[model samples]
Target: MTQTGWTAGRSARALASLALCASVVTACGSASAAGRPVVLSYYNEPDSSPATQDAANACSAASHGAYRIVYNKLPSAADLQRQQLVRRLAAHDSSIDIMGLDVTWEAEFSEAGWILPWTGSEAQQVEADTLPGPLQTAMWNGKLVAVPQSSNTELLWYRSDLVPNPPATWGQMIADAVQLAKEGKPHYIEIQGAQYEGLTVWFNSLVASAGGSILNANSTAPSMGAPALKAMQIMSQLAHSPAADPSLSVQQEDQNRLAMEGGTAAFEINYPFVYPSMKSDNPALFKNFKWTTYPQVSTSLPLHSTLGGIDLTVSSYSKHAALARQAVLCLRDPANQLEAAVKGGLPPTLTSLYQNPAPEFVAMYPFYKDILQQLTTAAVRPKTPEYQAVSIYISHTLSPPGSISPASNLSSLTGQIRDALDQKGLIP
Candidate 1:
């Protein structure tokens, strides 16, 4: 029940004076939301857990009747959520006042001018004391377009009962898994291998960890050179080895988590959510469930595990933009961020939360030290206005990892991305 202790910031103070009259003063009680407290519709992915609704409730109470944040749950899929938000925003609909955006959507939404960027003191407040990696995702063309609500990064989860020491390098991991396979033990290495956003994340991590990026600094075209080839070689090696899951081409995060918990996998690359799930579903296996830093592509190079999570933004078309912004601040404040972290398994974006975690937080995240270390070097996916299109191109080229010809596949990817950037390639 302890607080995460992040300052509520200038946005909360500025918003307090508007409690008497709603931000939409003239439109108050004019339409479907006829009441003293203006209804702020918050569209986000469905969270069966109390994290989302609870944050909404806390923020509404803190508003002192200035606004009521109604949680409108969207589809669970990332692409579907983006589609819904894009369609509504394109129509200039005011129904969606706030949205929970995927980290990768900041650039696209900001470029489209669908979401308002936080400026002045509010922007300073949001940026302060936040983890640099998560904060990086909220910036677009030098504007803080969104506030990071929570963040996530993958780790190498292994069974300690079988392996005495965790593999530090990808080559070592594959060699270990292959040997276990020969001994007829649980040796499958689980990862996100499906032709979707997960595949893009995997490829991005590999390239970034090897000191290369999928796109140049400007994110206009492919930068797949030596580092990319190294990443491709690693991906192909795993896919062609005995350590790969039988359903590697079709597996996503949940599938990878399930394989690890099903006792058929000796290793898994996934997020911390798998920690609690394993404890609940298979206590015996959970006893041996342990985690380490993500296996790296090179011993000399630092890992750049892909970052994932939700960010909160005020819709540009909202009638009550000020109130929406203020409520968003409260929704992601320390108290609520801690709630989401301790209960929902989502990590807080604030640096202090990891530096000085409370008892409840520590109980849920005993490995916070490792997580923080990784977060310090975490990398975001390709930052571009055409991120979705680029993701599609990268995912399709690297799908069905078992068939990857690193050199050939990389060349095809380079050409597709170039044409797409010049508007000569189709999205589908």
Candidate 2:
């Protein structure tokens, strides 16, 4: 687990952000006039899955005039969404009663005192039947700051026609790709190698699978020693191979999906969304597409793919806290989660949803078993308020995977992370 202590006080950047927030915060109506349903403004990313909107509608109706859960859609990009919420929360805007926070944002929002911690029976209710990985991300400093809504992890997707069996380890996968390349076949291994959070997720997954972590136990310094270096060497090896994508350094998840669908690649490490996308966009290729657990760094160690998801949180600035909290619980109820899984391709956070899942869910996620197993042991990124800066620095050092010089780059990365943690680094 990553440490998320925030007692060192705000950095200059945070202070400047707060100052900016004070300057441009907008005004909105009160929670309610009186006797009117309290307008619980639920701010979230656009509802890619109908489940999000369905939950909001369902909860509002269930409130029975107590509150109306208004679905306020934010921008698509994660960073853009965070910027909007942070500015509003910093200025103590009461308009936002509930927020759908990205898992990484939970620690930052909680540490900044922008989100309320769940306690008493509410906390227990949130904890009940939640999968460990998603639930872990919903917490900060040993407190539940949010409720897990939807969760996701990557699976090793492959062209079954190209490879009768999936590779169990990274080395084996690379070797198989190389052999296929020699035969003039579509052999590229698709992965997220772009200089962004995706790159951080990639490296974090590799390090964890190699039995190491990016930060020390306390999250104050680097803990990436030999294991991280070994992980880096594998990245370098893949980058140098002919089986690697030529645009590897620039590829993100969508690009990887496109590459595989375009038939230039035989393998992909991506989320469940690709399964549905492939079926819709390329039926022929989708016919041979198969998935398995994420590749291992070592046969001796268990695979640990990084976790991705959203959490439902109540804003500290909300005037309708009581209503918002009630809505949060309802929004993540099993029915809504199932809809999100079957319709939106998102995995549910509730563990019970996976055991003998709905037939519709099974149809969408034939590899649900792999997803459940990997998520049970999924690795979270560093849990400090400085996670964004740390990710920027690490990605800066590791971008263009082919350029990775294991030993020296590892040392340089260690120094950069330390600077980021100390709040003195310039990532760019």
| Cα lDDT tens digits for candidate 2, 3-71 | 123223335535665665576554212322343577788998898767778888888888787887878
lDDT per residue as tens, model 1, 17-89 = 3553466576544532444588899998898789989999989988887898889889988889989999989
Local distance difference test scores for all models = 0.89, 0.89
**TM-score, cand. 1:** 0.91
Q: What lDDT would candidate 1 get against the real structure?
A: 0.89
Error of 1 at 167 (Å): 0.5
